[model samples]
Target: MRIVLWSTAIVVLVVLVGVVYEQVGRYRAARDFPAPGKMVDIGGRKIQLDCRGSGSPTVVFEAGLSVDGSLSWSAVQSKVAAHTRACSYSRAGLMWSDASDAPYSARQVAQDLHEALTRAGEHGPFVLVGQSLGGLYATSFTKYFGAEVAGLVLVDPSHPDQVARVAAFMTETRSLRSRIAVWLAWSGLLRAAAPSLLPQAPNQTARDSQAVHAFAPKSMVTQLVESDATDASLAEAGAFRNLGNRPLVVLTSMAPYTEAELRGMKITPEQGKQVQAIWEKLHEDMATWSSRSTHRLLPNAGHDIQFDDPAAVIDAVMSVVETVRADRDNGSH
Candidate 1:
């Protein structure tokens, strides 16, 4: 019994040490790599917002499920900034942003974004560029504050009905893997394996990689918490139908997984095709949300279309920007 107690105590001590070490590393990463954006206090919390260029209709970039946030749009933001005002912000609990006590619902996040922009003196009628989960938040913004949005560019956005539609197809193995990933993150094991968890280069820059590694735990937790309320958020968004005459551009990625990825996901070719078909169908449905909406497919791009083919994203934003300008000009006449 004494030996058993000693073994357990040692194990606990090791875990505690690992956690502390990981946290210290995270702190160092944050300290060493300073945020490029200004820290604006939206109430109690500070959000990192980076804006550039000058124009009437500001373009705001919203990131996906990942923690990189503004960094995710670094390339595209610079290009867009060349033409007009382009802004990218980190959501609460993301890199350089204060943690939030409020529920991570899409509407609440959208509200936070609105407050952050207002505090930063970035005005609208704004063009919203949202990818993956950010697309949902942008939709919430449109529904809640339609007057503020001039246009929307959704890049491989997540569908509200996706969970229900794919529940049967989802395997327990995937859930188990996800749970293991969360556990690894919480225990600081993921930070130890940061290199593997955060691949550099095409996926991210050196600075972005470090930030992702340091804040991955918080980011993962935020994603799961937000995911819990997706159903309710979707229900609320569904209520806001017919987005008036707002111009909407939906970019859908129809890229297929490589053989290695297919093997990892254990998805057969037929199953993959079915999934793609469903995804495209949902994109088509999303396009119908606005009378002036266009849906385009990126055959060679993946879910991160902005990252894969940023020029396409830039073109989409520019198209919307031009349309908005034209509309404004015509309205005055």
Candidate 2:
């Protein structure tokens, strides 16, 4: 019996080692992906930034949770840049940036972005293009620094209402708290298991390949993994849901993949399809919640609509850019 117990212990140790090894492998092999551009020091973090092109109302790209970073914008960045100033940046702790800071919140993230823009010499009258989690940041900009924003883009972003919606799944807020505890614990274990990985690249790459890959070019995947921006972005999901208006262009997907996005959440694909149907009804309700907003439904897109359909994203982006230009010309007058 003692021998059997010893063998079991040995087996457990071996299994643990394997898990550690696999995670480390993910960290190292992740290097095979993209690398971030130059770093812009923002507060204590060195944020990665890519700025190109020249025109009025600089177009800025904000990637969502675990995004393709510069890659996500790759499809539309240069095109917009050709007519204006285009910028793409990686938030702290994601890929190219360091992971020295503690966990960050939405306000903290927006501030970091603001500082990064300042340090990078990126002025306002900004046209913000953000995807998924990045959408939260973009919207938060509306909540925090609404005047500075010229235009906004929300690419199938996380809705705070979803959190409240998911609340029905549990017995009460207590269970929700418990689930949060379990989730944090599990994420902590995973992070502890993969120290060698660059700050936030691995997760971002997976997000693009899995859900948001529709429009993300293969190159942007590199910066997404190495940049630590994903964590900061997720931390601010709450603030975005509370966002007011500053001219937002929300691009939603037609194809429902709630089963895929909510593979973890209690939501289902059918339910997501229902939401898509509601968003499609925007033409009917535009006078209400979305006044200055222009809603475009992509035809062959999935949850990551911007990617599944680049044209749709390009259309939204161009629309925002045009508004930015119109605002600029109007300002001159």
Candidate 3:
């Protein structure tokens, strides 16, 4: 009985220490790294939006799942901004954005973005550049607000049917891992290990992204929420099949999964190859969504094309922007 009581007390003390550590870490992070952009109120909640440059059609960036919000576009946003108005924003519960009790779905995310842009006076004709899961959200945005969207750039985007098609990707173990990540984040263990866990890229943008992710405790929770709603989000995005004559650029990464990645997914090399084949096919199908679409395969790039090759992404965006500009000038848009 005494041993049980002592064990309980020790656990309680450890938890208290963890909570205090998290609080202190959070305070220091907030002090050191303030929001780098305007916090525009979207009704009850506020979202951080960083806009730069100036031109007719604004370029908006949508980040991937479990990323550092607007900071994910740090490498390419400024370069794109130089030619046209480019903006990146944090979704609710990520980075500097306020969290919401409401469920996180693609539609809700699209609505939040629309409200944010409108309230911030960042009007469109807009070109949306989405990376990974962000591509689905961009598709959802176009499904609802097609008129404002002039073009789209999907960088190794997630396919709507990936969960069903990629057997190695949607496993019970993967779901369990996501749940474990949330617990780690809540316990502040994730923050402690974040520096070592994230990629040790040499650039300042990478370091800043790492810092923001390490400090954001709710980021994991938000990621899990988004993961849970993946099916619904995919369905919502998949509903939009056609983009008419709107310029579209689908960049597919040809990098194969590494041996370690295959081991983690518990799939054989043959199975991994099959998965890649299906992925490429899906991108090809996505290219058919627009009459003026250009599907480019990057041999040296990976899923995070924005990071793997920012110049490729910039070129894609510029190409789409130029196409939109030409259409506008010809009064054919």
Global lDDT of model 3: 0.84
**Residues 1-333, model 3: lDDT tens digits:** 999999999999998888888888788777878887799998888999999999978999999886488888888999999999999998898888888887778888999999999999999999999988899899889988999999999989988877788864535444675578677675677677666556543233655866665555766677768877877888778888788889999999888887876787778888877888898999999999889999999988867788788899999999999999999999998
TM-score for each model: 0.91, 0.67, 0.94
> Which residue pairs collide, candidate 1?
none
Best by TM-score: 3
Question: How far in Å is the alpha carbon of 327 misplaced in model 2?
Answer: 2.5
Off by over 4 Å in 2: 1-34, 67-70, 100-103, 165-246, 258-272, 278-291
lDDT of 1 by residue, 167-273 (tens): 65544333666657776665777667667765663545677777777777766666666656667867766666566778989999998966755675567877777
Candidate order by TM-score, decreasing, is 3, 1, 2
Runs in model 3 lying further than 4 Å from the true structure? 168-170, 173-178, 201-206
Q: Which 10-residue span in candidate 2 carries the lowest summed lDDT? A: 211-220
Q: Which ten residues in a row have the lowest lDDT in candidate 3?
A: 197-206
Candidate scoring better on TM-score of 2 and 3: 3
Measured on C-alpha atoms, candidate 1 has an lDDT of 0.82
